[model samples]
Target: MEFTRPLPAYLVTRYHGWKATTYAENHAWYRRLADEGQRPRAMVISCCDSRVHVTSIFGADQGEFFIHRNIANLVPTYEPDGNHHGTSAALEYAVTALKVAHVIVLGHSNCGGVQGCLDMCQGRAPELEETSSFVGRWMDILKPGFEAVKDDPDMPRALEHEAVRVSLRNLMTFPFVKEAVEKGTLSLHGLWTDIGEGGLMHIDRRSGQFTVV
Candidate 1:
């Protein structure tokens, strides 16, 4: 197959610049990573939003995190019917293969996917109701979360936090994840960040409340 399109010029320039500067500065480190392979300690499931930088937030290095980005950072319940499952695949590799010690579901303020879910739940986004809309189908995973916080004064923010809880609950549905947790080899955490204020919150597993971190 012949591809007609070419990569954007600015990206090409940036790639060359990174190769000359950052990569050159860290040549030995990059070589070690390439030779040793990745041994990330944590698997961070975060949003696809451009604003939420998981590495920057944690001050993590290139090989420190196995990051997975998805709409609303949602994790669907385990369904191994032989169909395509991107997030599940990532989770399996992270838990069973990589043996990550921690799995963090990172939600953020002003999430577009969460807002879309709210709109769809409120009967506002008619297009999202269609079966053909991929985003709509994905957002369906968060509908239960919406139900829990639909009446909140700040439904969007509430649902954002609910998204993390929903994903954390869903993460347990995977047998490997559950087994790892039961074996004391793995732990799960839920976190939310305020994009505008650069604030962070951690969910208390016992009380299910998000407290400032």
Candidate 2:
């Protein structure tokens, strides 16, 4: 009986030492936080991309953040039109149920979904029905950003940043989000990260600069 296992070595090693690696002497803290209950001050909306984990990147331990991820990290405006609305539902819970103080959208470079929209714009990817299955449907959220940045030299990065900006705006469409902000209970933030440059940028509303901090 011959079988194949070509998984990455690090994954294998980590799994072999799961408990020790995951807790890493933080068992007490994890237990205490678990007992005290989740009082996470923020809910993060980020891409489902593997590299963009908010908890690991920020060194956030258990009970530190309420996180959500989706394709391209889009938060469509509230609608009663019978869509799945998974992201919207999660937003409602994090803001209204959890009463999070800050809602942050985390966008990043080299996003495949963003690049796909760019491909559609440049006429590389066809708009045929059922092509690339759900990808075409999912990337529709970035259509406006594609139109906005397709002419720029920095089209790629700019569109990614635009995604973050748009998501922040969409967050307000939820009544709870709006009320929280109106009453000074909630704030919106945007962030962009670069894997190539090893840089992180936070949004400045006045300047619209994603300055690294």
Candidate 3:
């Protein structure tokens, strides 16, 4: 259980580089942010995959976005069970406290979490079905999404897009989120990133199709 350790040399060197460059150049902005607190315009829920860089994609500066990264970027249905729920907690804080104007679910092509869900649903990954499996339970949130694309010839890709759709649907399940949307105080969006192509696709809710943005 011991946690004390030195950071790897590469990461430490990178941190020093950032400190000397971006941090130094934006020291005043960082101080202002610390003093005034964050008032991000949007809340982005994206995958934990290192390849998906939300800030880089949007060219957003520090404190411009309230970002939450999780496996598959999945948002579970609203469940007030008095248990720990990281994604739900972040959503609540962002919608109720931060008053962010927009909430975006950012999924990506070649998402490992989506692929895992596909594998589990197809009986290819029994390990994920075990009750003790953390990833299995977390990905269970996307079961309905996987079902929507299970029969497709391109299940992985389809499920990736569906993950965004599923998250948007789940966001509405939260009473606070729904109220904000109904009141026109908040908006929801679904987006999928093509990692290899360096392109972005926004879901057309009306058409249920991903159109290039």
| Highest lDDT against the true fold, candidate | 1
lDDT of 1 at 78: 97
Between candidates 1 and 2, the TM-score winner: 1
**Global lDDT of each model?**
0.96, 0.83, 0.94
Error of 3 at 115 (Å): 0.7
Q: What is the descending TM-score order?
A: 1, 3, 2
Global CA lDDT computed for model 3 = 0.94
| lDDT score for candidate 1 against the true structure | 0.96
Candidate 2 vs. true structure, TM-score: 0.85
lDDT of 1 by residue, 1-213 (tens): 487788899999999999999999999999999999999999999999999999999899999999999999999999999999999999999998999999999999999999999999999999999999999999999999998988899879999999999999999999999999999999999999999999999998679999999
Compared with the true structure, what per-residue lDDT tens digits does model 2 show for residues 1-213?
258668899997887796676676677888888788788889999999998878867898778789999877788877868878888888988988889999889888899878877787677888622556587876777787777767778878888888887788777888888999999989999998886776889998689878886
Backbone clashes for every candidate come to 0, 0, 0
